[model samples]
Target: MKKNGEMAVRRPDDMHLHVRQGELMKVVVPQTAAVFKRAIIMPNILPPVTSAERLERYRERVVAAAGSASGFEPLMTFKIIPGLSPDVVQELKQAGALAGKLYPEGATTNSEDGVSDVQTIYPVLEEMQRNDIVLSIHGEDPDVFSLDREEAFLPTLRQFSRDFPDLRIVLEHLSSAAAVQAVAELPNVWGTITLHHLELTLDDLLGGELQPHYFCKPIVKRPSDRAAIQRAALSGSPKYFFGSDSAPHPVDRKHAPTARAGIFSAPVAYQGLLRFFGEHDALERIEGFTAVYGADFYGVPKNGDELVVRRQDWTAPDEVGGLVPYHAGEVFPYTVIPGWK
Candidate 1:
């Protein structure tokens, strides 16, 4: 329990979460399920989930993992491809997909199946727009604009918005100031801020000693960019919300000779956010960023379920399921008090 007046709000959804398949899924799903009432599961997996059929199978696996965990049915999304017909979109909507994900080719982990040509996907995008479907984008260029991918991709995304004004678009994990500004200026664009990106920068991760933990795609930028994102997240704007982007890779992969790309914060997500907010003296806005904004933007009903974060501290397990490492170490100052048994 908290020392005095301290209390936790309800558990929040992870707008972005990656639970890999088979064994890894079995190992990781429970950790996230214990905290988040629902999560928008990423489709980038081995043989990425691009079809309705595959999405169902994945959903089944997730449901099975939820088992007796009440209020823990994590929602899944289809990473739609150009090859998928409009009818397919309608079919998946009928199947209960919360949204669809769009990844530009080779942008991040397991993204080879992503769209190679955005133009080719226009028909599918149009279909989604008509159906009131949301398109969650990876938001980066495939090549050339490496360092400035977010800026480079804006023109294309702007055109997409113009072509499909009604489509609900979410730009996943906005890293740079330019990205945040673009999302802020665009009417249809909602943006997510990842926990890792919220905390560190590219130079902090790679420049001095190669701190692999700070490495993430659309890689972190200058301090000025960080400041901008901090402002946007705290601004209480409905268009911006919290997404841990809690991707997990085996400790071997993260600490390897060639470290892999991802961060696993599922275990300590809420506490970390609380610490970050409290340090900034922005605790009151925590609910806006973590729960209200995300639920409102996604059209998900507010989960009446409440969770408390006691002042008592806890540390994330160094290794969960004997693979993925907890982001940083387990030095959190809060614990989620779940509503359900």
Candidate 2:
């Protein structure tokens, strides 16, 4: 439904996003739902969406939020906790929840309720394997490697794949060379790279200019590590896909003395990628990263909806709906011209 010759492209899915809950959800959900046909919603809510009943309620709320927006009907996928029993996994799968999300405790915001030990949830893993359910991992061991958790976590996750060959595992927002290599080598393992990590490096963190917005769990790595991630994302491997991991925090929270870490890139994610691709002369390969690869990796159907990325210039809001805003006052080179039916 886009204008002719406008560089329209199929709608993209956000494999990872945190739309928060309640008031914050009301403000931010529309921006993402407008662009992405579906998203793997994060489970790190205030109380944590750990039970089937809570997940159902959360899904209802998300649906209600979407209902208020015309032409926007984004699918909400529930992220399961690792503590659920095997029976619970079967029940949720039968009822059509998308997949499970495993957050190692203390890994990031609101993740205190996440699984403290992976071994403690073996029963749930068994059920997920039996039910053909996908398990999305945060990919860090809370205790062992503070700054280098990805290096410490990949081996355990690789072992899990070996133990449960049938279970689909997605390593979310992978920021290390080891993670990229593990996903490439493992048959059932898939990995997602976020736009923030794809573009920045540790020096950015150390310099403290971008600071909070650039900070995130399994924190950004050295420049060489980022180069490895960039290579893997452009590698055209089916298992390497895109996930914005577009977490938004209020401007006040972001600019505070103890600012929260997250980047709200949903509104401009594709444009950012397109610019990167265009500069790299990989514009033609954008489809692999934006649409095809993620669907194939997750076994979800490609979205029938389409959008356009025009060459028009636009500035991202300093604040949208009273949220602090992502890249708060920066300008970008492209815009996502949406035309959802």
The global Cα lDDT (0 to 1) of model 2 is: 0.76
Segments of candidate 1 deviating more than 4 angstroms: 1-5, 324-326, 338-341
Model 2 C-alpha lDDT per residue in residues 1-341, reported as the tens digit of each score = 13542566778777888888888888888877777777777767867665677777787777777555534443334445555666767667655666778877777787767787678888888888887778888888878765678888877898899989989998999898888889889999999988878888887876666577777777888888788889888877778888988888877887788978788887667777877776776766777887888877667788787777776676777777877554666666667775564
Q: Give Cα distance to truth, residue 201, candidate 2, Å.
A: 0.6
lDDT of 1 by residue, 259-313 (tens): 8778777777777888888778788788888878888888888777777767767
Candidate with the greatest TM-score versus the true structure: 1
Scored by lDDT, model 1 comes in at 0.80
TM-score per candidate:
0.94, 0.92
Estimate the TM-score for candidate 1: 0.94
Best by lDDT: 1
**lDDT of all predictions, in order shown?**
0.80, 0.76
State residue 197's C-alpha deviation in candidate 2, in Å. Answer: 0.5
